[model samples]
Target: MGEGVTVSGDIAASSDIRIDMWSKLGSRVEVGGNAYLGEFVTIDGKLLVEGDLDVGKEVKIRGGFEAKGWIVVRNPVPVIIFLFLYIREMMRLGKGEEIEKAVEELFEDSEDSQDFEGKEPSENIMIIPAGAKISPEVIEVAGEADIGSNCLLIGNIRAQTVETGKNLTLKGSVYSEGKIIIGESSTVHGNLFSKGQVHIGRNSRIFGGIKADSVLMHENARVDGTIKAPSGVSFLREAAEKQILVEVNALGKGIVSKARELPKGVLQDDLIKAPDVAEIVSLIKSSAKAKNGFVPGRKRKTARTQALERTRRFTGARTYRKEKSGD
Candidate 1:
């Protein structure tokens, strides 16, 4: 055969096999089927056969070539078939309708026939529904995407910037390459992870952990778990107040413990202070002035006297000063 010639069967030569140009083979070119090509041999043609083709150097082929018994080709058909099948299966599972349809058509007949007798028709076919919901394509960014209010998302979302508006709810996790913001009246049940900043608006509720470079909570916002950020953390006034209240409990315990640790003399010093009745009356007169825009007159004084008598029965304060002059 010529230098670029292609053969379908075996080619046996007594001398060395050499070709300056490309040489192709449609089928296996068996050299005695037992002894293959010598070392440093090259076959440019694609080899396809049920038998084996052994060679020393590289063998180039086009399309798919198969050697079932013992394949020594540079490119094997079985590997390509396996890879193709793997990709096909992946596409099918990815819900690609075109790929799924092609695969189904490849395995089943295209013609449709009515059921004969009482036998059920074959069910190898599948129909894609018209209203099938598909997940949204994820948009990834290195910066950020500010989500406005009242936005509807049907698919996965990923961004570097995520700013949610009031009354916004996402169906999926919010993965931010940078920062995230949940505005007022928003609710997020999914996880939120950001590399930069995370701000939860007032009246927002987050059921998942919040991680970012920095975290800020507005007034009345509620978080159920840990908030971790590298740079800074800001708490609302209400949250700070609650934290102060929590610390108050511990402070109360410390106060009781300190009192117990004190010596008898220190305890007696605390109990020796006498109640000042004149100062108490002056305080009441000031309070009455502030409430009634002036000091209490005769009628107001009579009301206060009655109130004091009622409180004295429950309280230990029994001393009373009637009028400015001590009585």
Candidate 2:
């Protein structure tokens, strides 16, 4: 799904589900395999994941969540970098031809796909603009969120990182899993909290207390309630606060605009490390996970269930899946 798209009901995917930024799901989400959620995505109801779950920052799954596999939250690497790493690894394993074939499958049209020659993916996609309000309710994001100067907002803000532009007005609390920067001359009616650090800007006023790992405030800033910072609190001059704000603004813009993919390639004379022959042999001998009628999420006792299996031709191994009920 694209950004700003809102789904009113539950979504059940047989395989993976990839959501773009700022999408909202009103109900439960059940993924049969892995799920990759973009920044600021919200699932209003329960989320069940069978395989791994990788999510960007500022994501909110308000109701609850259950993962049969791993739950990792981080920004994903770019497609180009991923492809490069994959090709390199396959080459080391003497399987370069397999990667080439996969690339061909993606770019080349086949006779089986001729009927879909002219169709666009618009029918299967939705796009929501960033910074657009689709609902009157509070917005929760999984990535860093920035509120511009002189803006007024209601309800609490939840994000991985947060920055409020100068002269902003907000009625709700700001919660950040990372750092938070409250802009100059802004007013917040609610508390400000962060897991990392907080910097309150010049002439800003906060009605509620502030809690964070560390706190930095301008000398002119005022907080009506108590301040709690385990690391300590420090005050900066107005110019210093302004400098910090400028730097933070620049960094935030860079992170959003740049393609900063992770796991950078380590080059030693433009050569990667070669795989060990022993390691490859060991990998081939490793046992595979047993396949059963296991599926992610709660199984429906009301529905009839059947186990379907097929034996592998060469290895004599079997694969199994749960048959749909009443089919």
On TM-score, the leading prediction is 2
Residues 66-92 of candidate 1: C-alpha lDDT, one tens digit per residue: 555574534345656985987678786
Superposed model 2: Cα runs more than 4 Å off: 1-137, 238-327
- Candidate 2 residue pairs in backbone clash: 3-128, 4-128, 40-142, 57-142, 57-143, 58-141, 58-142, 58-143, 59-141, 59-142
| C-alpha root-mean-square deviation, each candidate | 23.6, 36.3
Which candidate number maximizes lDDT?
Answer: 2
- Against the reference, the lDDT scores of all candidates come to 0.55, 0.73
Q: How well does candidate 2 match the true structure in TM-score terms?
A: 0.37
What is the C-alpha lDDT profile of model 2 across 211-302, one tens digit per residue?
Answer: 99999999999999999999999999643211111112322331122442333563333432223312112222222342444434534343
Worst 10 residues of 1 by lDDT: 239-248
